[model samples]
Target: MDPKKIFTTILIWLPSVIITLFFIPNALDKILHSSEMNKIVSNNAILIITGIFLLIATALFLYNRTIVIGTILLASYMTLIVFIHMYKGKSYEVAILIVMATIFAAYIRSPFTFQQKRNY
Candidate 1:
């Protein structure tokens, strides 16, 4: 593979992997009612629903065809988190960082890049 393609794949896949890993454990905590999530959300129903959404979003992100949708879903979720954190008078830096990183990766991996069309 071309070095550029390899780099782009790394940029996309690395963050995707990291984001998925980040969300999975949190999702599990919510579903399993673990202490990690209990400190944040108290409602079981909300936790379960959020956890399920995270799993689905991660699945969508990992699959090439659904990556765009997955990015949107995950980004939206993260954005919501940012607001929630701010509302609770907590730092939202992590959520904001993830959202920005995900958007950057999505741009880099976008199928509609000008170079692809020009190469055809």
Candidate 2:
């Protein structure tokens, strides 16, 4: 077994879990309650698409399958989220984006990514 990838998997899952449990909910709340968010999502199907993606991403991450795909989806949604916040004049969006990127990078580099590989 490649110990490095195993470590990487842990790193990836850590954020995946946090974002799924914490950040995602907060984001969804804003997207749901704020009139501004409703407009962004109401007119643009892209936002809704990404919203659905968050659910898919969480599911994939939880099952530890198709994680890279899940991460890619998450990255896209978060990127959009950051920009949305910035457009709304939220100053902390960039910081959140950076932290999320860092966590994602760790997962992308984790050893556990090689789920099909066996210990030899």
Candidate 3:
């Protein structure tokens, strides 16, 4: 593989790995009724649902065939999280990182065609 491509892959996958590590454990916490997670989402049902969505979104993100859709899903989820944090006056710093990571990954996967060199 080209060095540039390797670097690009790393850039894409690094964020993905970080996100997976974060969300999987968080989802598990919600599923297992961890007190820490419960503080953020009081209702078990809502927490479980959100966890499931996170898992599915993460799965979609990890698979190359669904990268675009996964990025979209992740972005949407992050946006919701940002708004929730803003509403509650909580720091949304992590959410912002995830959002930027998703956007960067998506761009690396499919950059703008207009920015590419064209053949006559």
Candidate 4:
């Protein structure tokens, strides 16, 4: 296994699992404090749906068959998080953005990916 892919998968998987634990309450707080999350996914139904997607994405990240999709999902998620922070006029831990960007780069470099058009 590529060391970078291993690192990226670990990075995406951990926080995704952690976020699933607090999705509802955190969404509630976001809705109260910021307008972006509410605007994008206001109702509990959408929140639940996205939350479930996060959970499943993390699980898929654990298996080889579904990892690219998981990386895409997680990358898009973290991008949105960065956007949300900017939209709401706030800044967040730079580490988060850096991690997200690094995972994205690692996924692109992963030898298991057909899109890379190379073999390890």
Across 30-83, the per-residue lDDT of candidate 4 in tens digits comes to: 434443454555675566566666666655554567767766666677677777
CA deviation > 4 Å runs, candidate 4: 1-41, 93-111, 118-120
Off by over 4 Å in 2: 1-14, 23-39, 43-50, 98-102, 105-109, 112-120
TM-score of each: 0.77, 0.53, 0.74, 0.53
Residue pairs in steric clash, candidate 4? Answer: none
The RMSD (Cα, Å) of candidate 3 is 3.9
Runs in model 3 lying further than 4 Å from the true structure: 1-12, 34-36, 39-41, 110-120
Which 10 successive residues of model 2 have the least lDDT summed? 26-35
- Candidate whose lDDT is highest: 1
Q: Across residues 3-120, which tens digit of lDDT does each residue of candidate 2 receive?
A: 9999866875666566677546744654464445654556545544555666666566555556666666666666766777779887766657655763565465454774587789
By the TM-score metric, which is better: model 3 or model 4?
Answer: 3
Alpha-carbon RMSD, each predicted model: 4.2, 6.8, 3.9, 7.1
Query: Ranking under lDDT, best-scoring first?
Result: 1, 3, 2, 4
Candidate structures ordered by TM-score, highest first: 1, 3, 4, 2
What local distance difference test score does each model get?
0.79, 0.61, 0.78, 0.58
* Residue range 35-79, candidate 1, lDDT tens digits: 445457677787788889888988887777887888899899999
What C-alpha lDDT, on a 0 to 100 scale, does residue 8 get in candidate 2? 68
